[model samples]
Target: MSKSIDYGNMMHRAMRGLIAEVLEDVGANGLPGEHHFFITFDTRHPDVEMADWLFDRYPSEMTIVVQHWFDNLIVGSDGFQITLNFGDTPEPLAIPFDAIRTFVDPSVEFGLRFENQDGEEDDAEVVDLPDLDLAEALDLDKVEDPKPETASDDPAPAKDADVVSLDAFRKT
Candidate 1:
């Protein structure tokens, strides 16, 4: 039997690191030029901590917008903390990186989705990541080389260059 490389796990780790990078940038310097984050996480995850009211409201999952009105946004290696208003009261939350289900910066149309692995019995499931076009994230406008179109009678379907796939590493 051929061994399949666990590209999915590696990609998940990389995407999480990317999330950290974006958060670090936001923590150091305020969000740049309309850049904002829509972060979703599993509330039931062990590493997540929030108010009892919030858990009652969002029993399974919760999504927070880190655009405006958030205070003391601190991004650490393992997690992040921020204060947000919930019904006129400031609610502080501490969320670990593993509990994150999705991270999106809609301003640039960039996003990432992670598998909800908490309490899962199967570790062999492959994770499907979203379009990871991070060219805008790293500001690599002048450095990237444009792709050359292949000559064919049939025209190729339109697709964004930012979308990447890991199928090549999977065993057939």
Candidate 2:
């Protein structure tokens, strides 16, 4: 009998690594350009950690949104720890990478789903949620920042001017 490679498990590991890298970046630099994450994990996973009330509420699976407000995002090789607000109460959670069922970023309309088969290795599935408008779904208004100064003594230029002009040539 010939042995076959476990491609499904290999792909799952790669996908989890991708998630870890993204989380690590966010933990270091913060979310950029309105990008955020919706991470759903299996609450029943042995490595999962959360408040008892939360576990009781979500007994099987729970989805947490990492957006406008989140704190203490520490990513480790095995899992990650994050504190999120739950109805004005901040709750800390520890979720193993293996427990993650889905990771979605609505800003760019990108998502990944992991399917676990009867306690066997997981298979990755790319999920595209097209028609999902985050702005309307979240019901939040967009906040625009004022034009940034270009390290110049003169008055700040207009938004369009700043965009057209390169920073290197701008007056200091």
Candidate 3:
């Protein structure tokens, strides 16, 4: 029998490490410039800690925005803790790194998605992130459109922007 390398698991570890490093920096110096994050994690994870109300509301998975009003960000080797406002109610949550499903920073059009490979039934639904006007978010008057073929005299819509995928780096 031949042994095969587990590239998928390796990739997940590296991506999680990248997330950890970014959060660590943010925890130390605060969010720099206009960078913000939309982190989605599995609420059902055994290590996840949140208010009972929150658990009731988001029984499976929940997405939180780490933007202007977040506080008490503490990143650890296995997880992170943060306090986010829920309709003026401050709620602290502890999320293990392994529970994270997706992380996105629309300010710079960066995103990461982690898929389940353990053969467990993944009941998480596709989450639609709020559309962001990149020009307004970045305080830019005009942003160049990457697709010249579809270019028009009018400024390109933010939704028309291209998102680079990790698959691009994979060997065929």
TM-score of each: 0.66, 0.74, 0.69
Tens-place lDDT digits, model 1, residues 58-89: 79877676665566779888889977655446
Task: For model 1, state the Cα shift of residue 18 in Å.
Answer: 0.4
Candidates' C-alpha lDDT:
0.63, 0.72, 0.67
Model 3 deviation from native, Cα RMSD in Å:
12.2
Query: Residue 49 in model 1: shift from native, Å?
Result: 0.8
For candidate 1, list the clashing residue pairs, or say none.
none
Residue 24, model 1, lDDT: 82
Q: Give a tens-digit lDDT track for model 3, residues 1-172.
A: 6499766667777888889999999998888888887677889999999999989977987767676666789999999998875655677899999898878787777767776646743223222234544344333333223333222223433122221222221124
- Candidate 2 worst ten-residue window by lDDT: 160-169
Best by lDDT: 2
- For model 2, residues 1-172, the per-residue Cα lDDT tens digits are 6399878888889989999999999999888887878787889999999999989977987777677667799999999998875645678899999999888787888878887778677778776567645454333342223233232224443221100111111123
Residue 82, model 2: Cα distance from true site in angstroms? 0.1
